[model samples]
Target: MKRSAQPLVAAAVLAVGVAGVFAILAMRPTPEERPQVKRAPLVEVMSVEPGPYEFVVRAHGTVVPRREGDLVPQVSGSVQWVSPALASGGFFGEGEPLLRIDPADAEVAVESARASVARAQSEAQRARRELSRQRTLAQRSVASQTNLDDALNAERVAAASLREAEARRVQAERDLSRTEIKAPYAGRVRSADIDVGEFVARGTSVAKIYAVDFAEVRLPIPDSDLGFLDLPLGGGPGGGEADGPRVLLRAQFGGEEQMWEGRVVRTEGEIDPRSRMVHVVAEVEDPYGRQLASAGSGSSTPLAAGLFVEADIYGRRVERASELPRIAVRDDATVFVVNEDNVVRERPIEILRTQSDRVIVGGGLRAGERVAVGLSEVVVDGMTVRPLAVDPQSRAPMDANQ
Candidate 1:
């Protein structure tokens, strides 16, 4: 009976162990039943059409006076009055009085000189009458030849004295005119150094005037660019109308954009020793007179002397060069062009020029070809790309903050 009971217990234990193993096996996962992760979508991109574009070179430069002149007092005198327009940045016309020095002393000198001239004229007339009388007396033998000679010498001396007095008078008048300062050109007075009651010595600066009728822009180009310049016919860099090269200049001052059309008038004739750059001068008409006028009190925008500016000199434009967005060209001078099958091919390109947002490709690109713009790291040569149709207005990428 004990043997039979042991067999039944063993069979029951074996049956329970087998059932537990089956249950564990049923809950275990198979290779085909594992979880899979979904991938994020590729970044959307736009395409650019290649075409002929203009080439431009950008450089920085300074705005300077077309012609600047210093107003200096020719005669010394105390300042008696100044023009209401004599302040710094004041505008005036040609021959306009800028300031007035005390001319009282100059006037007194003029009067004194006139009186001397009158006295000299009386003496000269008397000498001439005596010489005539001596000549008549000598002819009649009433006067000796020596007496006639003495009378003639006296007349000549008197005539010399009269001429000297007249010259002194003219000089005195000129000095008086100098006391009244006048504008040398039609321009704005940059500065007035003298004031009412201020004593200015001779040759002292009374004011500074600049002509805005035409303004000058001095551009320093590398000596290599000399070939492109149309040098003046007879005069080297700075002379002759032939030296002037037609150029377009756009200027901005105080948030207002101004367009100036001008020509390269001349060159500085020599390259700078340190910079190896040749100074090219271009002339533009100050039509509105804004650049030559002072702020608020003038008709045009005030272009102050010595203001720095950005200049764009239009070089030769290649008619057949391929132009694309700057982003389409990589740093290695390679561009990724999309084939008809929508496959990207890396093509080597020769960059002719680069403008602000565009680049001109002189080689390795054909017209009407689509180029990838703003590509991601995943995009490479021969990689498949699905370009989304980009809206012209809404193509800009959304910022992360948005």
Candidate 2:
């Protein structure tokens, strides 16, 4: 009976303690709930303006002469006198005497031929007089018909001999003229192998020369780049500079940069089978002529042959095109366009041309449209952002921040 009473007393104490704890928790105030706040990303944006855009195609080539070949002599003889203009790097005018061979032999030959012609004329006159005398005698019954016939034949033979001698005289005169070698055109001498008293054979090359009136550069451009240029299908419209496109050629000269203006004169009829490139011939008029004096341009330097050059060919103009920074465009021709509220979305644009640092957008864009030039790489579409307007040229943030 004593053990059962103790157990009942312990259970009553434990129930009282539990009731006291619940009453204390019920008296505490309820905690207040709070909300979380998120900020949008900051992005650099630029306003795109659409207008006419001119495209340029670049290529490289080496300068070359329009006409170049070996200078060969027509007649063979020892070079008695060599002109100063016949040496290497020398300039000469059209028909200028380059050298003179020993004309003593040629002059003697001419004189001898002339003397022979004079003797033949004397013999021919004598034959004619004898033939007339024979005819008179035959009519008077003094000379027989056989003698008349003989005189007539002799006269004919003498006339033929006179003609032969005249031909020899003409030939000798022509040979005498050939002894003095003259330049065929106004040109510069590339090299010379003959000098005073040097024996050269007929049709032998003695020097090299090239015309200096103009220079031609064979510029090979990829077949795909043809669309940018306005070229005729068959070939460039003739060899003159009257038509086709203009090319600005640049090169290093006199330890400085230089520029020359040229025109597309023609293109090769057949494409290069190996490279699949079309070779267009550009002509620069008066390459050795005077140039405008300017600083840092080496303007006085002539566009000499064999100099490697870079060309910038002016192409057609595209209307309603926008120019954008290269980074703003992706390889798949898409860009991020920001809206008025700074929300971003991807937009596809037609890329007319691509350069090292810029891209020409031909269509699918309008004026006053904002393009996000700088943004997070992993930013997704329809994401909101803090827009910062920036200058396109300097790339510095402008005063406006949307």
Best by TM-score: 2
RMSD of 1: 6.9
Residues 127-193, candidate 1, lDDT per residue (tens digit)? 9999999999998999999999999999999999999999999999999998888888778777777
Candidate 2: where is the Cα deviation over 4 Å? 1-37, 119-164, 236-239, 290-299, 355-357, 389-402
Backbone collisions counted per model? 7, 0
> What C-alpha lDDT does candidate 1 achieve relative to the native structure?
0.73
Native-to-model Cα distance after best TM-score fit, residue 187 in candidate 2, in Å: 1.6
lDDT of 1 at 141: 94
lDDT of 2 by residue, 102-179 (tens): 888889999999999999999999999999999999999999999999999999999999999999999999989999
lDDT of each structure?
0.73, 0.86
Candidate 2 TM-score over all chains jointly: 0.77
| The best candidate in terms of lDDT | 2
Name model 1 segments beyond 4 Å from true: 1-54, 126-148, 222-263, 287-300, 325-337, 342-351, 354-358, 371-402
